[model samples]
Each structure stands twice: as structure tokens, then as C-alpha cells.
Target: MSDDHASSSDTTAATPAPRSLDDALALMRDLRARCEWDRVQTHASLRPYLIEEAHEVDDAIAQGDDAVLRDELGDLFLQVLFHSVVAEERGAFGMQDVAGALIAKMHARHPHLYGDGVKRSWESMKAAKAKRSTLEDGLPAGLPSLHRAHRLQDRAAGVGFDWPDALGPLAKVREEVEEVASLIDPATGAVTNQDALEAELGDLLFAVVNLCRKTGVHGALALDRTNAKFVRRYATMERLAQADGKTLSTLTLDEQDHYWDAVKAEERAG
Candidate 1:
């Protein structure tokens, strides 16, 4: 009599190693068919994962490690597969449609590359076909503030509404800073009108973001670098305090400053 237990061949049949894009899509399909979590996921339900995976890919890219970046990119591609499968289940579209649409758009965007034509600006071609009545027509509200500001400014610049150079944005940044300063109470050194202060602060930050764009600097990336630098220096300060038989919490401002200054001096010397 034949045994009912699963053998190595049976296990191999159940779990397959994907060898290509088609194999990956088939693997995703199999997961949806068998896994309860994957089976129940809808496009709307998977939206957050889509956003999170994109950010993880960004972080991996910033880390400058090819292996990690490749892994993150694969995770991001899984989101694409997930959405495509969900769409296919609903009879909306399939992965082939998704890939076909991308290829069509790329070909249309670069007629010179795919057809017999002169090189033309893809944005201008898109604008001709796109019925965008406002500058923020295509910009999503959920975009990061700094990136949104940069995109909005770029759109305005395309229509001849922007300043010619960095000097104009620099001047606007100074003006916005002064307005924010005026909102603060000089005596108490605190803002009394919270609403007005917030509005002024928004203006100041928007101006600064615009200045960053004008100067060819990425505001979010610049802030990310500063955040990392601060964390590194703060950790070094804590370590220095610990070595001196003190906890960071027990150290006074002067004591903390001694360690902070030492860290900075060492960094400069190194």
C-alpha cells in the first residue's frame, strides 16, 4: 500500500523557487489561492503597504548598499504584483495590461526613440493632451510637504509664473522669516496667537523649501542628513558621559556641552 504522508517530492511541488518575472507572478497567484491573508487583501486594503514599500526602497537607496536596494526594490515590485492580481480578480485588468500600458506610455512619450520623429519635450506633449485647469491638477494631497512645494513651483515655472533665479526665492525666504519673527512676543519669547504663528511658520517653511529647490538642493534629503548628523553627535555625547561615570540624564547643560564640544572637535580633527 502507498503511504499517505507527504514526501520530499510533494514538498518540492508545494514550495517553488521563482526563476523569472512570470514565475514570481505565478507565485503571487498561488499565495492568493492558498494563503488566507493574501487571499482576502483588496487593492484598497493593500494601499498602505504600497506606500511603505516605496519608502523602504528610498531608505535602502540612501544607505548605498546594492544588495539591500535590490531587496527593497523586489518588495516594491511585490506591491505592483499585488495590485495587478487584485485588479485581475475584479476583471478590471491584469499584469499584462499594466505592462502594456507602461510600454505604450513610454513609446508615446519618446516618439523619437520609438517612431520617426524629432525629439520633443514629453511634459509639453503630456500637457497638450492633459486637461489640467490648475497647477496642482495632478499633484496628490498626500504627497510630502517639501516635495509638493517643489512640484507646485516647477509647474508654475513651466507657465512663466516663477522667479528667474535663486535670489528671488532667497529674498522671499528672508521676508517670510521676518514675518514669523514678528509673530513671536518679544517679552516672553513665545507666540501668543497660535493660529497666526502657525500660518507664518507654514509660509516660512514653504519659502525655505522653494529656496532649496531654487538652489538645486533637495529639502527632504538635506533634512534627513542633518537628522542623521544630530543623532550621531548626540549618541557620542551620551557615550562620553557614560565613560565619565555619569548618565546623560544626570548631566547638566554645561556637562553635556563639554561632551558635545569634544565630539565636534574630534570630528573636525578627524
Candidate 2:
């Protein structure tokens, strides 16, 4: 072979294709070594980025953008490694420690994988795992209240503490809504009792979340999708108004409603 070709072959042979986890770790280590922003980041500094990256990954998944999803997922994993690195520096835990803990936990939870016998189904295995976890173990307090409640309900349900069907939760939701309306005292146009109003509102929200839990719907994600759709539709309305030489705020309520209806029709038609 020619000298240049032999040199290229030697280089290719020396560099092995990395396993997925190993490639991820190597990139993380390289960032910590050479990236200025990454080098200075501590767990506290990376907290917001961790949440942001996670949301970005979710967005990519929803949009079905494989390249963007892969990149966002890597960013999310980097945050995990960053936190582990900081913890390691503080003598708390390292990457190996994190991996070991997760592996041990998974093995312990999956008795089908490492215990009595093979699991017949994933549902039964999940139930077994939930029974093994404490009340606080399955649901983090820091999660959004709706999400936390759903998770808490699921865990509780695994232990036989749940509504029998959607009908029961639906009835409870209606009762809570009625109590909230009663708190308003519509004739006065004022909340004569603030405590009653607040209590009723809380109860109503809790009941709605319970209904969602029973119906296998995620209240938080449902709200998030609606919020995103509203923003997009409103932006389209604003652009249409601006193109027609008008400010959205200056338009009459009826005129704005007309534009909103048009936008809704367009979206539906599309």
C-alpha cells in the first residue's frame, strides 16, 4: 500500500467505534476539560439548564425531529454528567456511583430480571416495584403539583387506594365545582368569604386532577399543549392585525373575536 494510505489505515484501526454510553461520557468529559462555560458550571448553576434541556428534548420528541431530538437528549445527558462531576468534586458521588446506584435500583425493582422468576407482564412488574417503594420514593415534591398528584395517585393505586372508575371521580369533580360556585354568591358579585373561595378553588383543582388520574390523562401536559397552541394562534392573529395596519390592543373586542374565529377556522381547515 502507499505510505499515505497505510498511515490512514493505521489511524482508523487505532480509533475504535465508541459504545453509546462511553461516547456520551467522553463528550461530557471533553466539555468539562475544554469548554469554558461547562468548566465553571456547578450543580446550582446547571439546575435551570437541566430543566430547560429536558423541555427541549420533549419539544424535539413532540415535533418528531430526530436530529434535534438526539442533540437535545445529549444536552440533557450532559447536565446529568455535569451534576455528577460536581458531586464527585465535593466527595459526594461520581459517574460510576450514579451508574451503580441506578443499576442496583433497577435490578432490585425488576425481580423478573434478577429474582424469583420471569415476569408475565410489565404491568405486574410495575405494581411489584411500586409496592417496594415508599410513598415519597415514587413522587418527588419538587415536581409540578398536577404531575406530582398524578404520580402520587398511581403509587397509591398500586396499594389499592384509588377510585373504582372514572364515574366516581367525575361525580366528585362536579361536587367540587358546585361548592366553588356556591362560594361565589353570584348576586353580590364578590367573594364574601375569601377562605371559602380559596378552599373551594383548591378542592376543585384537586378534584380535576383526580379525574385526570382516573381517566389516564395528564393534566399538566394537556394544559401545556393548550398553552402552546394558544400562543401560536395568538401570534398569527397579531401578525394579521399588524399587516392590516392595526394594533391588537386598539382593536375592539368584537373585532378581535372575529380575527380569532378566523384563525381558529384556518387552523381547523389546515
Candidate 3:
């Protein structure tokens, strides 16, 4: 063979072809049939792992690492394949069924792209599919409180039951805060009515979420940023304390506060 042709043949031999979807499905089927561990896993058993993989994908996105995001996405895709294989073994459904349903739903939802119909809001389309009797119906009870609050507000707004503007939500926030404050005894600085306190605090959070919605800020993302900021500042405080020959835990509250202020000032100056 010519030298260039020989080099091309060697490169092809060294690099394996990318696996296809069919290859992935076949691998999952084989694992389910032959691997003792894979054979025993159920949907319920894998719930925690699915949640973890999803969070890892989110973390990868936040880090802006394309390689990590690709790997994390692959892990998530495998979970879907594993569940599909399990269902296939039981003769319930398979990956084909899942893909078919997803395609059908997408086509139905995006009429502007797939059909000769006027475009409608996704929320309206989903509401029709939900056939919910109440505004709050179909919301998962397991959703995080802030997310649930946001969804609840969205549902209410869909039916014209929302504040007209940002000012309304801002005012509502102040009202809820006052309600919460009324439940506490100023002298003792303790909540006088625990149940009322809880309810008022929930109202306050819900009002804040409404304000966030009006301002086009996502409550979860905002909280995540704040949490990251706190972590960074606290870590810096710890490092500063250590540099001064004392651990954070060994220092007095005032000393720790001093370091916290220094960290904040340094961050601000930067």
C-alpha cells in the first residue's frame, strides 16, 4: 500500500467507531439478562441514583466543563435505558415506546413547527394535558418548597389570579413579613404561635417567589448563587483564621465575625 493509505488504515484501526443507539440498547439488554446486580435493580431502587446523576449534570453545566457535561449526560441516558430495559423484561414497554411517546408529544405541542396551527403557550398546552380540577392540581408533593411556590404562582397567574405588576408582589411581601412578625413576642423574641408562625413564614416565602417571578429571577438559581457566595466567603474566613494561627472553631464569635467582614471587604475590593 502507499504510505498515506497505510497511515489512514492504521488510524482507523486505532480509533473505534462511536457506538449507536441500537448498540447501547443491546448492551443494556445484555446486562439485564446476564449481570446478577443489574437483573435485580428496580425503578424504585434506582430513584436516588437517578436524582444524583441529574444533579451531577446540573453541576457540570454550572462548571461549564463540556467533557464533564457529556459524561454526566451519558450517565443520565444510561438510567433511562436501564429503566426501559427493566420494563421490556416485564413486557410493559421498551425504549421504542418511550421515544415514540416523546416524539408524539413534541410534535403535538409545537404546532407552529409540525402542523398548520397557531402557536400556543406551553403552559396552556400542558394545562390541557393535565386536565387538572384545581389550579394546584398535578404539582408533585416532593418538589422543593421554593420550586413548588413558583409553580403555584405560575398556575394562579395562568387563570388571571396574579398580581398585576412587581409592585403588587413587593407590597404583598411586606404584608406577609408583618404577619410573620406579629406571631413573635418582641420581649422574649420567641414565636408565640408556632403554627401561625409556620403559616406566615410560608406566606412570606411565597410572596418572595412571586416577586422573583415578576422580576424574571428564578428563585432556585438565585438561592444557589447565594449559597455559593456564602460558601466562598466562609471558606476564605476559615483560611484567614488559619493564617492567623487559629482555627475558625477555636476563635470567639466576635473574632470569626471580624474575619468574615475582612473576607467580604476583600471580595468587594476585588
Q: Compared with the true structure, what per-residue lDDT tens digits does model 1 show for residues 1-270?
A: 011110001112133344799988997888789877788888887777777778878887888976667666777888899889889999999999999999999999889999778776665666677869876888887999888888887766665667789999899999998898898888989887899999999998888888888899988888889999999999999888888889998888998898999999989999
lDDT of 1 at 91: 96
Flag regions of model 3 displaced more than 4 Å.
1-17, 185-188, 250-254
Give all candidates' CA lDDT scores. Answer: 0.81, 0.75, 0.82
Tens digits of per-residue lDDT, candidate 3, 81-187, equal 98898888889999999999999999988999997777976677777788899877878778888998899888777656778899999999999999998998989
Every model's Cα RMSD, please?
Answer: 6.7, 8.7, 8.2
Better of 1 and 2 by TM-score: 1
Score every model by TM-score.
0.81, 0.72, 0.83
Cand. 3 Cα-lDDT: 0.82
Score candidate 1 by TM-score against the native: 0.81
Lowest lDDT 10-mer window, candidate 2? 2-11
Residue-pair clashes, model 1: 0
